[model samples]
Target: MIGLNHYLIISGLLFAIGLMGVVRRKNLLMLFFSTEIMLNAANIALAAAGHFYNDLSGQMFAFFVIAIAASEVAVGLGLLILIYKKNGTLDLDDLATMKG
Candidate 1:
């Protein structure tokens, strides 16, 4: 039967993929997506552990994480849009070289 270990393994794999994306991606949007993936992976692990322990705290923390991710996306996207409009590109290297 599926258990916490199985869920944890899946979560770990997803987090690793997200980490790799964060390391390898160069586009601003892709970086945001990678961070979201990482957050979701953490949520999965937290929810699974909470279920295993029959406790609400981990699940509650996961909910908070989701809320934070939502806010982050809202603000991050706004900044990205402004940056793209000002710079005309979302490439990390290009953005890095930008100066006032």
Candidate 2:
């Protein structure tokens, strides 16, 4: 039967993938996507722990994480759009070289 261990393993794997993306990606949009993936992994682990413990705290925290992720996406996307409009590109390296 599936258990907490299984969910935890999946979450770990997802978090690792997201971490790799965050480390290796250069584009702003992809970095945001990677962060979202990491947040979702945390949510999965939290929800699984709550279920296994038969307590509501972990679930409640997971909900909070979800809300935070939503807000991040909203603000990050708006900023990304503005950045793209001003620079015409989302490459971090390119942006870093530009003079203010």
Candidate 3:
């Protein structure tokens, strides 16, 4: 049967993958996606713990995290779109020399 350990392990793996993507990807969109993944991993862990402990607080926190992640995605995507339009590329290296 699946247990807390299993959930924790899965969450850990997901978080690691997200971290790698955030570190290695050069695209701004991919970086945002990676951050979302990490947030989801935290949500999963929180929900799992809430279930295991029969408590509501962890689940509530997970909901809050989800809301925050959604807002972050919306804002990040908007900014990325503007940046892409202005620069014509999503490459981080190319954006490094950006000036106002």
> Against the true structure, whose TM-score is highest?
1
Give residue 82's lDDT in candidate 2 (0 to 100).
96
**Clashing pairs in model 1, backbone N/Cα/C closer than 3 A:** none
How many residue pairs clash per model? 0, 0, 0
lDDT of 3 by residue, 3-73 (tens): 99999999999999999999999999889889989999999999999999999999999999989988988
Better of 1 and 3 by TM-score: 1
Pairs with backbone N, CA or C atoms under 3 Å apart (clashes), candidate 2: none
Off by over 4 Å in 1: 98-100
The Cα RMSD in angstroms, rounded to one decimal, for candidate 2 relative to the true structure is: 1.8
lDDT string for model 1 (1-100, tens) is 9999999999999999999999999999999999999999999999999999999998999989999999999999999999999999999989666576
| Positional deviation of residue 81's Cα in model 1 after best superposition, in angstroms | 0.8
For lDDT, the strongest prediction is: 1
RMSD of each: 1.8, 1.8, 2.1
